[model samples]
Target: MRETVYIFLKAPVAGRVKTRLGAVVGMGRAAALFRIMTDWTIAEAQKGSWETVLAVDPPAAAHKRARFWPPRFRRVAQGPGDLGARMARIFRTAPPGPVVIIGADAPGLRARHLREAFKRLRGADAVFGPAADGGFWLIGLARRRAAPDLFDSVRWSSEHTLADTLKTLPESFDVRMLETLRDVDEAADLETAMFRGRR
Candidate 1:
């Protein structure tokens, strides 16, 4: 079975993407940063041996032949749902084998992190890379068995996001944790990156 990575992305349109970050730093700037991060993530993901798939938002974007994302890789619509519903769709529909999912918000993401997720999945039923802001940046499942309750009652963006998600998993499933990384969701989160010339 082949390992795969699904990248969740929204169309990098001003006021439409990165609204939180946009509220802090002009919408156009936020959109530009979003594009840069998306591009960087795609390049890093391609460095890994696993297949790369873009799970695009707005559904219609996936249908367009010439969209913001690269045409070389496969693209699929995220469909209608909240964050958890959309993600659950991928876990339930992905091909046999381990599957890892990530968002483009974490600028520190590297190919090594993805490789580590797959490695941990060799023994663990699920793996999560926690975000400093209480959400998660990466989630992977071994998929040896079905997990219908994995996202049940998940509080999307609250401080208990990870904790709530963990509660949904079965007690029998062994889970692994990765290092906590910061997501560029607010102005403060982007301050350090700006000083470091992230772009």
Candidate 2:
């Protein structure tokens, strides 16, 4: 089956990206760090044998002309909505096949992790890579059928985010969970990632 991996990213502009981390590090430094992390994440994700799609926030047209991102992958705008709505839109509109979505700030993410998620999707209707913070680092759908409204009413960025999302799915839906990974959000997270030699 065809597979597409979507990396959600914001334009790497100061004061726009990694704001939480910026609170500890300067905004300019945070943005610069984010740029590096984003590049590393994209490179690692591309190592997998799947088509890569970049889902940019703040509109695709605005960044399409921007030279920050590489020209190798396809790009699309993550149109209007909250995190859930935007993610659901990707699963809803993507071509028929398994689709895996991940954030650009997860420095610990690797090609093997993506391969594992796709592998699990073969048996499960949906798969989630749990984050240490109770959120999720990755979400994948087998897409053997139409995508479900699994993101409604979910408290994004909160500890209950993953659990809330799970509750929205049908009881019969077969779900799989992947290894816990930490996503860079604050200074502490960055410190941990660096200490772990992941970044």
Candidate 3:
């Protein structure tokens, strides 16, 4: 069976997607940028061999109904809960093989990161792509490291997130880290991502 890569996305509705970048770029523009980033990430992920699923908020994804979607992508709405809870549910219900979850905000992420994470999953219990903002841009779990506390008590948007997450895991657990990338969260991050895209 093919492995599943879950891409998490917020509704591309203006003011709903990029609330952090809302101050710098108006909510409408933030939403637009988010849509573009989502498209780019989805397109890049599609080039890989694994299966793709768009796990939208409340698990109800409008992307599936989106007229612009390419082929072979499925959509599922997120369930009610905090970020940790939702992620916990996915780790719990995911298929037997490794399941990776990636956020939509990392405009610079690419297929190579996914390939590396899957490769690392062979020897480690879990893999994390740490974001410059202190949170993670991607997470992958093999059968061994599926635990709820992995995401608990994480300072969601702070730089301490990776450290906190690491502390939650058992000492016996073998974790792997990947190249850190800047996530388009605050105003500066958005500017950086936009600048990089222009080059």
The candidate that wins on lDDT is 1
List, residue by residue over 50-86, the lDDT tens digit for candidate 3: 8888777744454446643444677776688877777
Residue 123 lDDT in model 3? 89
Residues 1-199, candidate 1: write the lDDT tens digits.
9999999999999999888889988999999999988998899999978999999988998988866988998999988888999999999898899999999988888899999999999999999999987889999999997787878889898889999999988889999999988888888988663325454
For all predicted structures, in order, the TM-scores are 0.96, 0.94, 0.91
Ranking by TM-score: 1, 2, 3
- C-alpha lDDT of all candidate models, in order: 0.90, 0.87, 0.80
Model 2 TM-score relative to the real fold: 0.94
Candidate 2, residues 1-199, lDDT tens digits: the string is 6899999988888999889889889899999988888898899889978999999878854357657788878888899989999999999898889999998877888899999999999889999999999899899999876546679899999999999999988888899998898888889887776337752
lDDT, candidate 3, equals 0.80
Q: What C-alpha lDDT does candidate 2 achieve relative to the native structure?
A: 0.87
In model 1, the worst 10-residue window by lDDT is 190-199
Predicted candidate 3, C-alpha RMSD: 2.0
The positional error of residue 37 in candidate 3, measured at the CA in angstroms, is 0.4
Provide the global lDDT of candidate 1 against the true structure. Answer: 0.90
